[model samples]
Target: MELFIRPNTNEINQVEIENETGTSDPVVVSINRILQQPDSSYFLEGIIYKVPEPLRSMNSEAYTPTAISIGPLHSGRKDLKANSLKPIYLRHFLNLAQLSVNTIVETVQTLEQRARYCYTEFIEMSRDEFVELLVFDACFVVMHLTSWQYPNLDTPNAVNLWQSWNEISHDLMLLENQLPFFLLQSLYDLFAPSQPLLEHQSFIQIVQYYFSEHKNPKLFFIDIKPLSVDDVKHFVDLVRMPNTRMYSHEKSDQRLLWPLNATELHECGVIFRSGDGIEFNDQGGCLQLPPIKIYDDFEKRVRNLIAYEQCHIGNELRNRVSNFAVFMQCLVQSDQDVKLLIEGGIIENYLGGINEITQLFNNLGKHIFIGINYYNSDCKKMKDYCMRRHHRWMTSLRRNYFSTPWLCASSIAAILLLALTLIQTILAVFTGFKERS
Candidate 1:
């Protein structure tokens, strides 16, 4: 027996009525929606983006802001304790600048649309909402940064009074929890004139000084030329600016086929040296890497930076932060590799566990893609050096025969004895030939 199902009469009547009325097709509606969207060129202007899901899934905590939310993307999150303090900071900021709320709000309103375009996601808030968010958040940021410069000078009490400065700094550096640099610069320009300390310094200098003083100054400031406000997208971009100078612009078809980890490279006569940038010395067989001090927040910092590169830096050759992470991931495979790097002064492991450091690098590049890795040529050179038979033979000889003083003396004696025996044998053969003659 076969069973048949009848269509609902209401649906049939609705289709008949729709046909009679010449209702629009679903495809037409979709096309209309597409037509209503902003031009495709507008998307390229977006500098702030949500971290991609694949990367966020690997470590959600690394990308999510814990202490505060700066922009529209994370404004709805209620758990952020610092949200309550934003208003207090804003009030303090107004008092310090002697500007009324309307003045700041009006200033932010002027740039609201441009700031909204800076975000990759379509901000769901109204114009008033966005302008208010920027006013409050930008003021908070300005006050917070000012507090660092003048801790005792009756700045915003709520800036660092309740929240941990480290936590606040970490959240500020997150890619998702960012406002446009232009927005911050605008706010700074308005209020900075009134404040004696910030009057002389540019916004970029204040930002650079705040981060350098709070975090590692050597890592951020040493050998890094100051960047203009136009050069940075946000705090994450500012952090990444120093590394951009080291990226190789040349592209290569070569890929790192057999990447040797830290231990293997060390065994193959590749010396690891701590430097300010990632570079390979082909003649000296030295792999120079920037010294990284790994603390508790180091993974979060690095992961967000890599995420920023994935979203913002279109040219793979320019993704220096991501490339460095990839290079480190390839270099560090195990705890032993971490130990080797630490011994070479290339890594300052404040997190204490060698295994954790190894795991951090191994997982950093999990969902990341590199169209052109900047370190590919350097790795290829190292691989070629490792593959040479003479280098291997010399390394083996040094390890097996000349590793210790006793072994070196014994090997020397053995070589001398062999030489003497050979000379004597030759003399004996000569004498025998003479006798026969």
Candidate 2:
């Protein structure tokens, strides 16, 4: 058992509390009694009584960290001082802790070793950085908690490693589920209880930290397929951003990770091609990072983007039928994200309300939508697009209408001239006798 004394002010003398454990009874009782303070007064700096034997015993069974709790300080350091504190000001810190049971705060980090990426860095990090990284890494943890089939074996750091992984998984589930209400409120509710080791601990601070000062290197992944390294070089050449760093030959102990937050922001997947020459079909790098600190901005942006994306596809489908089918069919080529969204019921909402679609034909007799003027009207766009695309497949719905014949204005004028010429010949024949007389 170790007694770590903390002081209120810089004066080490006023913060002093001495340990006086008696030679009688067991060491555990003496350790606990001395920690209760001879003086009934509260000190901002807590003093502890050290006991080697029993102190190690209780903690060994739990495998949890030695709990250090922040005790009675009534003021928000910036708002209320010792003399100026009201009754409400006193319990603020405890209230704050109760609010923060589940939230995590950490900063942005690039991809590195998974254990080293999350574990070693989590320990070395400032409290703000730790929480920020924890927020996104939590998402990854939730995504793959049950699958501990990798390097997380029984090492000395196994306990800490599992705890980190478990907590991260728990936190991700929390964030995803609570996005509807005040995100900051949800953050405070989860993170309040954690002992404040670093200054930036709030959920808002975690987000602000990302966009303000956090940035990682650029990243792009490719599964080594039939595509040559020279092809990569050529592709990079077309992306002609001179300052953009390119590294084809970089290798790592774990997975390939760039030290940039790009992995944290984008939705990622692996790309591959199948052939006899292929050694591994599953190739390409994963962007392994968490979401950004966009706060409510994230939700708003997502809502707008999804809504716009759905409408854009609808419009394009309305304009071109075969193109739209080709698009859906082409998605079958690599149907991971797209298929998931479809299965998740995101697409059904768009086209389900309409009965059928309208179609137009191109000069080449290619089927398309005659919907250039349709936009100004209040029509169901998504269903319109889907039906127009599906119209050719429905052979039973054929009908011939009184359609217009192809005729130019000049052709109409020529027919009128022919009628006038016959009229003139008849009129001349009737007037023939009068002209001879």
Candidate 3:
């Protein structure tokens, strides 16, 4: 076991504790206990993390949880207004589960160390405090998700509790403010044990509904496809799960460069139609994008998911959310590109003006590391289409002759003038031949 000593922290005079068998100084005993733990279960890496500085600095507000916090990272902020309500929710859940708060806390205490290991850093809270936090947070998730399951039924506290649903939803999806999925599931099962609240209620359905706008044929890129909840790590991971479910491109490994941006691609005869029913295909580079509305909150949600992927060692193919962000960034360099996408119905800009939407996507991939785009084959295919001689010739003709109104008018006038001259010459020749006769 390794001991990390900070430069200016309390100094240690000796390596080994003087009383090897007996109880030594309190600090020494703590250090010795930590060192004696097995090496195989030392540190669990990449489940959760503080956002990197560059990303955090871009828009610190996006990373901050506004209404509620789930885990230790943002648990006890004084500014959060929802902290007082946490115990109420916990008590409500306890009543539903038919268990006392003490019983639930003790149950959670059993999983304390295991749950602590799920985090990237060491948690500093005592055992009782950790158990309390877990019980409270886990209960919050269960109650929220369960309540959302019955959307049609009006709840008593709906208006007062979730007046700013958007704010709380965005905060929940943040990378750092997440509890492990298993904890939430255990609590949920206990709360809903043998009591079917609805005929076909599911945890996944509740989550999808919570995040979904639920418009017919949802105007956003929500994966309605049923996903196994077992594989999910947290809320951010669950939200991004759909994007990464794309079939592995046959040439996904190939370093296929992203094709030309929107205008250039259009010039090359590559059409950008809205993908109303776009399916995830293994064939890369075919630009099939689900229509998405770019609202003010869009950047916050997307950035959090990307930040989560950036922090973890994740599958390249499964990191489709990050890949999509990078892909969109490559396509949109300016307001004009955003305009093009808007025209194609690929992006519904509800964020008011085009510039804000443009800036949102442009800044998304900054300082983010990405591998070969999952759409490599599609890019290659587009490039090949662009390189076609006929397409190239057509593009040139459009650029040169038919580009402007004046050019079109001048070409038409020249053709008309040539026709007139030829007719006159023919008539003169015929008249001269007749005179000779």
TM-score, prediction 2: 0.17
Question: For candidate 2, lDDT tens digit of each residue in 1-437?
Answer: 12322222223322232223333444554354446543322222111111122322422212111111111111123421211222222223224344332323321122111212211111243344434433433332211221233222112334443343433222222111112113233333443344343234443333323222212112111212233222211111111111112221122233211111111111222222222211111112221111112221222222222222222232222222222222222222232433332343322223221121011001111222233321111112222322443332321222121112333444556678988998998899879967998
Identify the superior model by lDDT, candidate 1 or candidate 2. 1
Which candidate achieves the best lDDT against the true structure?
1
Point to the candidate with the largest TM-score.
1
Name the runs in model 2 displaced over 4 angstroms: 1-176, 179-198, 201-437
Candidate 1, position 56, lDDT: 94
CA lDDT of every candidate: 0.77, 0.26, 0.70
Residue-by-residue lDDT tens digits, candidate 1, 303-344: 888888887756433566676777788899999899888888
lDDT of candidate 2 vs native? 0.26
Question: Is candidate 1 or 3 superior in lDDT?
Answer: 1
Model 3 over residues 208-290: C-alpha lDDT tens digits? 77777422124323655786766767777777765322433543676757757777776765556676533323223246666
Please list the residue runs of candidate 3 whose C-alpha ends up more than 4 Å from where it truly belongs after superposition: 1-35, 39-42, 151-155, 198-200, 214-229, 243-248, 276-286, 314-318, 388-393, 396-437
